[model samples]
Target: MTHRYLKNVVSLELDKDKCTGCGKCTEVCPHNVFIIENGLAEIIDRDRCMECGACANNCPFEAVTVEPGVGCAAAIIKGWLTGSEPSCDCSGGDSSSCC
Candidate 1:
């Protein structure tokens, strides 16, 4: 099955101008989030990203950026278990806190 988290919530950003078509993001991404096409890196599946920061770290041209460890995965799993909307409530002293 294709794993997808909250739609349009991932922080992944790609600067196509800086990509240079190196294909490093495609190689390092665990979720196949990137694809090199026409000499530019593209974010093929942003929701599949687990916020692991691998693509950003491996991009030699500094084309990719993402806020890793933003509790997206945890929030999605929590939502699945509770049948609620995915949310990352990092505030302390709360039952719904995913941090």
Candidate 2:
């Protein structure tokens, strides 16, 4: 699947100190953004992230933190053309605010 969202737009922070190498993020990410290497979760495809916040939500140790939002480039362009700022409602703090 292809998305129009800008690459590297979403803020995804991984804290190695907090990460337990549980691999939950690997299991939840639909875009294969995370991989377990040597018992640690590493981001291998950050550009493919869709800001779904599934990894952040599923992290038991709160190792993954991301600011989820709609990074659609087309929407941003449309907003610029329409004289409005495009914003996503997803806060990425929890699953309830996910897009």
Candidate 3:
């Protein structure tokens, strides 16, 4: 089954203008969040993204960018376990205080 996070919360972005249709994002994404269509990469399911930053790191043309471990998987899991609103603590504080 496909896993999806909170709607409209993921930070994944794709710059189609910079994409080279190299399919690197498609290959590196663990969640299958991207797909190549019409010779360009498209965000098929933004919520499916875990904000892992693998796609961005692998994109040779720097077409993708995502703030990894910010407010997606870790926050969702923490919310599920604590029965509270999802929070990533992205206050730009110490790294140990985040997520």
Q: Could you list the CA RMSD of all candidates, in the order they appear?
A: 7.1, 7.4, 7.1
Quote the lDDT for 4 in model 3: 52
Ranking by TM-score: 3, 1, 2
Q: Which portions of model 1 miss their true places by more than 4 Å? A: 70-99
TM-score of each: 0.68, 0.65, 0.68
What does candidate 3's lDDT look like per residue over 56-79, in tens digits?
A: 888899889998754466667767
lDDT (Cα, tens digit) per residue for candidate 1, span 1-99: 755567888888998778799898888898888888888888887788888889888888888898876456777786789897766654546765545
Which candidate, 1 or 2, would have the higher lDDT against the true structure? Answer: 2
- The sequence of per-residue lDDT tens digits that candidate 2 reaches over residues 31-96 is 888999999999987778877789999999999999775566655665677777655433435465
**Which 10 successive residues of model 1 have the least lDDT summed?**
90-99
Model 2 C-alpha RMSD vs. true structure (Å) is 7.4
- Whole-structure CA lDDT of model 2: 0.80
What is the descending lDDT order?
Answer: 3, 2, 1
Give the Cα lDDT of each candidate: 0.79, 0.80, 0.82
Off by over 4 Å in 2: 1-5, 71-99
- Pick out the ten consecutive residues of candidate 2 with the lowest summed lDDT: 89-98
